[model samples]
Target: MKKIIITVVVILIFAIIAIYCKFILGLASQMANPKVSTLEKEMSWEKEHKLWGDYDDYEKEDYIVKGLNDYDLHVTLVKNPIPSDKYVIISHGFKSNRYGAVKYVDSYIDLGFNCIIYDMRDHGENAKATVSLGQFESEDLYKLIEDTYNRYGNIKLGLHGESMGAATSLMLLAKKPKVDFVVADCGFDNLYDLIHTSYSVAKVGFVLPSVNTAMKLRYGYDMKKTSPKDALVGNEVPVCFIHGEADTFILPENSQVNKAATEGYSELHLVPNAAHAQSREVLGKAEYRGIIGDFLNNIDFK
Candidate 1:
């Protein structure tokens, strides 16, 4: 009777562990596989925020750059009519496409910069694939940067990214790419904490560790290792970190943390009452543009 009871308890313990692991894997899968918005949804937001000019009217040059594993990255170059060698590559947030990054075009152009806005993998025109959160994203953008130099030839380059893109921009510092400056807006410091904060799970101590294991098993990347804060170690790239003060999602503290970690000239701006990726929308174009301009001036980024 005692032996039978002990066997049943062991079996129940194994069953509970299996159930918990299954749940953790589900969360990891959901986190990596996000539901991307349609082009129409992306364009509508672009149309709303891009109040000055019609995006369709720009001198647009499109291309398909090769990203990690030779994935096709849908890219577009919006040329400034003023004839300048300056360029700014803009990376949009998760679930958003190149069109979603249109709001920043006019501001960059006004600052005498040609804009290159591209769709990140699994978002926009690119074919569906596993999102690395920001692990391979930094490498993918590095590929685009290399291609940009090959195509444009001797151009003054800069980077501007929002949310995931912001994290991507900062993470690329690990490669030590030759870019003039980086403007990171509302980016997370790392994926693990981001998932925890986003889901607001109560038993995170029990939940996150299993999810980390699942992330490695399923996605070929570790959530704990894929961190912007770690990526900033010894990176000397001039970065302007912008975040919304009221952003409970990514939290304003992320920018503060990254600012402290960055080895280069770094600045943080927390927009009052702005939530998540709404810093530019809340600050207005002029104020937002001024911040970038001021950063460039402070860095002497000519």
Candidate 2:
């Protein structure tokens, strides 16, 4: 009887270990390398979701920018007819392509800023690579900012980002890019807490630390350090934080925390009845445009 009990306990211990190993590996791979939506699908998604913008109507040119690790980033230059020195670089969300930024183009153009948009790494037409949430992504955005400065020669610049792009923009602030302002929409404050919440919502929160460990081993970035809020500690650049009041995916508190974290001039606007990445849609074009225009004007983001 004693031997049988010992055998049973050993089997149970091995089974638990095996299950834990599998879960950690799967989670590390899944989060670090999610399947993204195709560019064509994202355009159709924007239309189906009633997002308004005509990418073809703009006079734009395409080119490439080398990012961190010499990774090539596909970029677009959409010009305003007036030809001004003010520029805004718009970054789309994770799983979305550069075209997803079209919805905001009209607003920027209306505000008299030329629009620059691009496909983030591992999204759209870019080559496949591990997603480090905001670590490498922030570096990539900084590269784009530098390239813009080199090409334009003394221009006022602003950054506009959605979801992951928002996080990227905020994270890059730690590097102190030379820019006028940042408009972040529906971004997460921390990758660790975000993913932990995801796991908790699925009833597996306890596994996150192990998974994070696996992530560091499999991919070379630490998940716990990917906090956009933490990045703003010493930043002085003006940031406009926008979020949907009803955003449950990332929650509006992400923007709230960001506004609180920034030592610089900041504004937090919550769009009523909007979900994740749906602030502009819910606020309508005029209201959405107004929020950004007012923020820029307030900061004299010329």
Most accurate candidate by lDDT: 2
What TM-score against the true fold does each predicted structure earn?
Answer: 0.92, 0.95
For model 1, the stretches where C-alpha displacement exceeds 4 angstroms are 1-18, 49-53, 199-205
Candidate 2 lDDT tens digits, 112-215: 98999999989888999888878999999999999999999989999999999999999999999898999999999999999888889999999888888888
Worst 10 residues of 1 by lDDT: 46-55
Q: Could you tell me how far off, in angstroms, the CA of residue 287 lies in candidate 2 after the best superposition?
A: 1.0
Candidate lDDT (C-alpha), each: 0.88, 0.90
Tens-place lDDT digits, model 1, residues 116-211: 999998999899888876888888999999999999999999999999999989889988998989999999998788877766645455578778
CA RMSD per model (angstroms):
2.2, 1.8
Backbone clashes, candidate 2:
0
Task: For model 1, name the residue pairs that clash.
Answer: none
